[model samples]
Target: MVLPTFVLSAALATSVAAYDTLLNFHGAPEVETRTIDDIHKAAVAEGGVVTLWHGGDEKTQQDALKEAFEKRFPGMTLNLTVDISKYIDGDIDRQLSQGNVYVDSVILQTLQDYPRWDQEGALLRYKPLDFDKIHPGFRDVWASWYAVVVFGWTNIWNTEKVSEGPVEYSDFLKPEYKDKLVFTYPNDDDAVLYAFDLAMQQNGYSWFENLLAQNPRWVRGTATPTTVMAQANNSYAVTFTGALGLAPTAPFNVSIPKNGFFVTWGQRAAILKDAPHKEGAKLLHNFLLSEEYQSPNNTGMWSVRKDIPAPAGFPELMDVNSTNPIDFERFMADRERVERLKLFFESKIGSAQGLSPLVDDL
Candidate 1:
């Protein structure tokens, strides 16, 4: 039964395509239930170590996670690498393509990458304990990825410098706020760009032109703007991105917009299909979703689990005025539109300058 080489190749291609389609539709089968102790024991037998690539502005941002994980799983070691989400996602792609993946799992802000990676069969489809308890919008139907924490952006100001903080996008254009505003360069961060896009949609392009006239200081990451405000170097800033419950309230106040929407999204986490320490990765994911880790007192942010109440003094995500978590997910899915918005904002704010916030140490 000799077959032509061309025919063989065609058959193989079709088989591969079919397999990918199946994966896209149903994903990998779910793993059996395992306690954290059971997973930790298996992980220790495999390698006793797990490498995680965490997306954030600075290495210190993940210090808490690292410390907590080590304490919770005594025998297992967690190697944490912190970098900008954009850079980490590209690095993960390169690693996967080269078949040399080093990271066992990822906790990232780039929500769009998870589904694409799942389609490529790059994610392990293991649902952690309590997977069924996660908020509906925060977890995938296929169990490929889920949100470990919720993040958002709003206005913040130094109370001593500005007696009254801006309550809406239009308030930034006032004469009182001129030369007193700091902003993250929307071109440099998709989240910041999305926030800016919402502002323009509500206030119009003319509002942006007027904002430029205010002579606001521009920086590379959302955290930098909050830093500027805290130092009183700027009287006000937009897009104060941080864990909602953790934001300082002393000399500064973080405010949700009185009119129009602010931005919020679940920061997603997943285990890599080719993880070197598969058991360890599973343990990490499970721990992240566990109640002990997701407690409001511990994370200082809204829990992705529906049963957990919102942090004290903060309303449930749904009750918040003029905000939608799903909108940010939709925004990230449209790459072409996001790129266009980036360029448009760059034209108004100028290119982002200085070292990346990940390495800037500021």
Candidate 2:
């Protein structure tokens, strides 16, 4: 029974290799196949229920989504929990720690959270059918998350009040526009924060210093600028999430700076590793990226899919000026730098005023 050391080592290595292969083998044949029909049946077999945590303006869209899902799948039910993305992430942390992890899938604008969760092995690594069709910049390198839509953070002005709009960030500093501009406090919204960051990098900190002298009003939420613009409460908003589709009839116009604007990868979605309804979760995840949901009229968002056309009245993504391509990984990883930048801006412009939407009672 005393074999040579080399022979024994070889035998042990072979056995270990075989064990590793067996351990890595994913057992589900249907999961391997990954067709829409297969996922549908699997979802139905898994009691046909999935809960989603969404961070966006999904309040009105969720109902339409539920009806559509039920119509398509007959028995499946979709549960949508809507709130700020940061709130959803906080809930996920609480739920996971408490051993309840109820939300099956998450669709949110805060992409920085996705990488963090995926690193902790919290997200399921399942790429939908059209994952390859998405632009490389929009999806995770490891397939843990994918951008479902596109949107931007930019400036807007009440056209009736100011017939001509400012085409540059510095334009807001003009004497005539002084004290007439309002902006969503950059610190309050990630998109606005990123936009401010980009503006600083492009135009220098002095741009902010001079602009601060204009006495621009600041609000907490990204929607506040557009809301104020519609009410004619402010002549201009230096930054807000650009969505022309919203209130198209209002006497307002939005514009991205010719020098640059921060366009964002909107509402990235991912499944949880321990999703309660695995099949239904995957099915719903894929359905959201399908041509049907990605259509502008249906979702009111620009699609990430290559074949889908740009939303009506919107320029092609390539045709626009997206200042610096956002490296979300680096942005999220360098927390200290971001904090320092925030401090610098606050020191120059002043601490953000008003309550954060995240903290404000719903």
Candidate 3:
């Protein structure tokens, strides 16, 4: 593994770094490098084109990823087609219907949502260099999944719209905000569902209920609500999404709320069990895990690569202290339990994505 180390002072928190140590978890390094540069071009030319069916709609995120991958793997061209609509609907059913697996690898919402992909012989696993750099809560002991990036949800607001509005969490539930609020439909994004779950843990079931009562517009992808906040002059919405960082060129802004509510890299990258392009897929997957491909700034919720310092706009995660981040094994093993939550919530309110045609298509 060509992984560098991350060295921290006695006071890990206050210590400053200029790209120093490479952390090792348990025993393995955070990232691993196989030196594919020699054949990266040859492999691509001989193979032709490669397609990456990724999830989500971040601003510069798509372009940033495409540029990095294409530049590294020269011979092959990358098809950066982000199928945001499917969002892990029915992986098995979709694969069965397609006759073959449709995607190479996927950046899913979270591993806890569907752990069967690795076991049902549906997915493969690969580890990155300095894998140990991340907190224990984010790692996968069984090697079922590895957090490619680190990100989470926090309230975001328009600098302009929010100037006179909320300064904290309680303001978000105010009666005045009304329909002016925009948020990703929780039913569509598992992370959002989990975020609501966290809110339930911190506040109560009425937390989301109050937010809903304010008449927030449900967006398709988690980032859409934040986008609207920046462009539409909307006050606030689920802002901690990666979309906030992707919009570096735009006027939009996202602020981490002062409260204890937070979620990270709500999305995870995993190889499909029956991946047709498993080799190339794993190659691409590991490459993304490397520091070479990630942004340099540290802030937005993205995969926490030691080399790729957090984005300038994002905040390092120092708040993830024992809120009992979901158990990957339990989530993966208890398929029925996840279904029960989805079903119960669906019965009560239905998918927020089902509300509008435009929003649904987003």
**Strongest candidate by TM-score:** 1
Model 2 lowest lDDT segment of ten: 24-33
lDDT tens digits by residue: candidate 2, 1-362: 79999999999887655334334433322223477778899998999899988775334435777789878777788887767776778888777656688889988766778877765657787778887777777787667788876656556677777766676777777777777677766665566677777777778878888878888777766666666666644455443444554224457766667775554555688888888998898889788788888887875545777678776776656555664334644564576876776786677667877565445431
TM-scores of all predicted structures: 0.91, 0.78, 0.69
- How far in Å is the alpha carbon of 121 misplaced in model 2? 2.1
lDDT value for model 1? 0.82
lDDT of 3: 0.54
Deviation of model 3 at 239, angstroms: 5.8
lDDT of 1 by residue, 1-362 (tens): 98999999999887776346444465355864878899999999998999999888867888898899999888889999988998899999999878898889998988999998888888888888898888889988888899988888767777778777777888888888887888888899998888889998998999888988988888877678767766744355443443335355677677777578988888999999889998998888889888998888887777888888887787887777788986788999999999999888777667889998877876
* RMSD to the hidden true structure, all candidates: 2.8, 6.3, 13.2
lDDT of each: 0.82, 0.69, 0.54
Candidate 3 Cα misplacement greater than 4 A, ranges: 1-33, 39-42, 45-48, 57-63, 84-102, 128-144, 164-168, 205-209, 231-243, 246-250, 272-279, 296-299, 306-315, 318-362
After the best TM-score superposition of candidate 1, give how far the Cα of residue 346 lies from its true spot, in angstroms. Answer: 1.4
User: What lDDT is obtained when candidate 2 is compared to the true structure?
Assistant: 0.69
In terms of lDDT, the poorest run of 10 residues in model 3 is 16-25
Q: Give the best candidate by lDDT.
A: 1
